[model samples]
Target: MIEVEVEAGAWTAALPDAEAVAARAAKAALGTVEGDVVVLLSDDAAVRALNARFRDKDRPTNVLSFPAPENAFPHLGDIVLAHGVCAEEAQVQGKTLADHLSHLVVHGVLHLLGRDHEDDAEAEEMEAEERDILAGLGVADPYAAEREGRA
Candidate 1:
């Protein structure tokens, strides 16, 4: 089960089926693991606050994932998204807001499952997983366009 909490925002108007995105993204990566996830659709300020408090970045990021304890089955983790950041990124990346949102959710879920992109090798592996999972969700490979620029 996926729970969506719109923490003081009008996300329903922008994303009516927010929870669906969370559920699909998480399930696509979850595989055999069974657990519930909560998606917080919040504004930039909320995300920034969390980022500053937890990561000391002092800025809002696209998504933040918080994993629960090891023994928490049927309860996986929490994914938080910044609306302003995601929309701006979608516009910049040439993707629909929905598609971008789906990708972020998938990315966040993967992080909860121990995926990271802190280095080149790790990023390549994680991006491969993201590409495979997003493909299954009918989303285009996000990095394809970036590679297009180089080629």
Candidate 2:
């Protein structure tokens, strides 16, 4: 079971189906995993606050994942998206806002399921899973930009 609580103020008008997009992405990422996820659709300022409080960062990012401690709850964790950053990235990356948001949800859920990119091997594996999951939803691979110029 997955539950995504979206908190979007003025951005709500732009993403009419934010919940659906998040659900689709989360469900795909949880193929073999289990747990509910919380999603927050906020602006850069809100995200920046979260980043500073949690990760010790001081800037807004596209997405931030907070995984529940091992077996702590029925919930996987929370996935917060900075709408401003997401929109900017989507435009720069040539992707639709919805598609980009979906990708970020998938990426966040993967982290909750213990997927990380702290190392090369882990990154490749996680990226592969991301591509596979996103492909099922007709979303282009989010890592396409990173792979450019590679064989």
Candidate 3:
């Protein structure tokens, strides 16, 4: 199950079908994984607070993932998205807000699935997976822009 909670009005205004988009992206990421995921659509303030309190980062990011404990079955984790940062990033990256949002959801879900990009090898592997997942969603390769120096 994927539950989407909209905590910010901007998300709705920016993407009225945000919840459906999130669900589709998350499901594409999960594939055969079995569990429940909660998605929080919030503002920069909420995300910044969470980032500071949990990650020790004082700034807001596009998305953050919190995985469930090892023994937590039927409950995978939570994915939070900051509308302001996401919108800004989408604009900067020359992508529609929906596409960028889907990509972030896929990235966050991968984190919940134990994928990390702390090293070159790991980052490459994760990016490959993201590209595959996003491609399945009809979203172009997100890193392609960076590779071509467009972003």
Candidate 4:
């Protein structure tokens, strides 16, 4: 199961269907993975605080994923998204907020499922997976611009 909690007002104001968008994205990412995920729709301040507390980074990022311990089994983890950062990135990437949000949710859920982009090979594999998943949802290739040297 996937749960979406909108903790920021901007999310709804910008996309009234934010929760549905996130839930659908999360479900798409789950595929063969089994677990429950909690998605938090928050602001930069909250995400910055979380980044500082957990990653020692005092900056707000678009998304963050905290995986559950092994013993937790079916309870996968939590995925948090910062509305401000996501909105800014979407605008810069020339994508809709919903598309970007879906991409980030998939990215975060992949992390929770033990997928990582720590190395080039890993990044390529992960990007491929993301592309396949996003395509299924009718979202364009998010890395197209980057591949074309436009990002």
Candidate 5:
């Protein structure tokens, strides 16, 4: 089973449906893992701070995932999402807010499962998995739209 503990209030409006989508993403991303994970949805300000502090990017990103520390009980890791960045990306990509958010949720979950896209090949593999999982959830292929000039 997968459990998600939300740490912020920015996603309260999308929480109900986001939880369902997040569960599906977790199931698809982790396969058979059994544990709990945390998802922190916050405004651009919080995310930007986290990004700058941890990743040294000095800017807010759509999502950031921090894996669980060694030997942690039932805690996989934490996923931090920036609401404003997500909304803007959704708008620019011509996808609904929920869909974009779902993609980011899945992306973050994949990271917790040890997935990485540090190179082109890895990114392609990860993107393919994301497309398959998101498609099963009735979300369009995020990369396909961009590749096809539909975004």
Candidate 6:
């Protein structure tokens, strides 16, 4: 079973159906991996700080994932999301905020499962997995939107 702990830090509005989204994303990404994951929803400033600290990037990102060590038992690490960025991306992509958020959650979960898209080939694989998972959740292909200049 997959477990999720949600932390709403510096977010203005409450996330609607956050638990369900997290659960779905976890299941889609890890399949039957028994573990606990933490999801944090925060404002742009917090996410930006985290990005700067962890990734050495100064800009705020939509989502960031930090995976636990291999020795850790039933713990998949954490996913941090910037609510403001997500909303803005959704607006720019012409998709609902919830859909964008769902996509990001799934993407982060995939990262926790040791998935990376740093290279073209790896990106293709990761995007394929994201497409399949998002499709199961009734979300359109996020990469397609990007390719069409809609995201």
| Top lDDT model | 4
Candidate 2 — which residues are off by over 4 angstroms?
none
Task: Candidate 5: give its CA RMSD in angstroms.
Answer: 2.5
lDDT per residue (tens digit) for residues 1-151 in model 6: 5565555532435456766776677677776677888877777888899999988999999999999997886887888888788888888989887778789989999899899999989999999999998998899998885677843
Off by over 4 Å in 4: none
> Tens digit of lDDT per residue, candidate 4, span 18-136?
99999999999999777899999999999999999999999999999999998997889999999999999999989999999999999999999999999999999999999999999
The best candidate by TM-score is 4
Better candidate number, 5 or 6, judged by lDDT: 6
Go through the candidates in order and give each one's C-alpha lDDT. 0.85, 0.87, 0.96, 0.97, 0.80, 0.81
**TM-score, each model?**
0.91, 0.93, 0.97, 0.97, 0.86, 0.87
Q: How do all the candidates rank in terms of lDDT, highest first?
A: 4, 3, 2, 1, 6, 5
For model 2, residues 16-74, the per-residue Cα lDDT tens digits are 88878888888988997656778778889999999999999999999999998877767
**TM-score, model 1 to reference:** 0.91
lDDT of 1 by residue, 22-130 (tens): 6677778776767888888898999999999999999999999999888897678899999989889999988987788889988888888888999999998998999
How accurate locally is residue 110 in candidate 6, as Cα lDDT from 0 to 100? Answer: 88
Number of clashes in every candidate structure?
Answer: 0, 0, 0, 0, 0, 0
Candidate 3 C-alpha lDDT tens digits along 54-102? 9999999999999999789789999999999999999998999999999
The lDDT, on a scale of 0 to 1, for candidate 2 is 0.87
**What ordering of candidates by TM-score runs from best to worst?**
4, 3, 2, 1, 6, 5
RMSD of each: 1.6, 1.4, 1.5, 1.3, 2.5, 2.6
Which runs of model 5 end up more than 4 angstroms from their true locations?
1-10, 13-16, 149-151
TM-score, structure 6 vs. true: 0.87
lDDT agreement of model 1 with the native = 0.85
The residue-by-residue lDDT of candidate 5 on 18-121, one tens digit each, is 66666666676666677677776678888899999998999999999999976995788888888788878888989887888788988998898888999989
